[model samples]
Target: MYRLLIVDDEDIITDGLYEVFNRYQPERLDVCKAYSAKEALDWMSRTRIDIVLTDIAMPGMSGLELSEEIQKYWPRCRVVFLTGHSEFEYAYRAIQMTN
Candidate 1:
């Protein structure tokens, strides 16, 4: 099974995503959620995750920073970031980093 970790500042947002993921049954991925970067890091250190879905603009450590750290530590894990910004710059950077 694919392990998935979700990071978002808002509990409701993560909860909604969890429900959606469950309803969609996205490849039977195991889902876990963290409301803060520190909490996410804690889980990451202890657990093995295949994918991470996170908000780009989060408190303390942003998703970009988290992804970079994950790249250095858990290189095989894939990161999918979400942002409220509709601008091209954020999307461009996200694509660039993921690619």
Candidate 2:
């Protein structure tokens, strides 16, 4: 099974994604939710995360920074960023990080 960690400052987004993944792919995915980058890091320290779905414009640590931290510890882990903002710079930076 793949371990998926969904991080978002908004409880609704985090909880919604958690429920959606659990409902749709319970057998294939072990989904976890985090309300902040700090909480996500806490989860990472405890267990191996295969994938992370996070919001980019968080209060403390941005998703881009979190991604860099994740890459340092879990080089193979995949990160997917989600944001309500429609800024071109955010998208550009996200793409740049993937390269």
Compared with the true structure, what per-residue lDDT tens digits does model 2 show for residues 1-99? Answer: 999999999999999999999887688899999999999999999999999999999999999999999989889899999998979899899999999
Quantify how close model 1 is to the true structure by its C-alpha RMSD in Å.
Answer: 1.8
Cα RMSDs, all models = 1.8, 0.6
Candidate 1's residue-wise lDDT over 7-96, tens digit each? 999889999988777666667778888998788889999999899999988889988889888999999999999888787887787788
lDDT (Cα atoms) of all candidates against the true structure: 0.87, 0.94
- Model 2: which residue pairs collide? none
- Which residue pairs clash within candidate 1? none
* Cα error, candidate 1, residue 30 (Å): 1.1
Q: For model 2, where is the 10-residue window of minimal lDDT?
A: 19-28
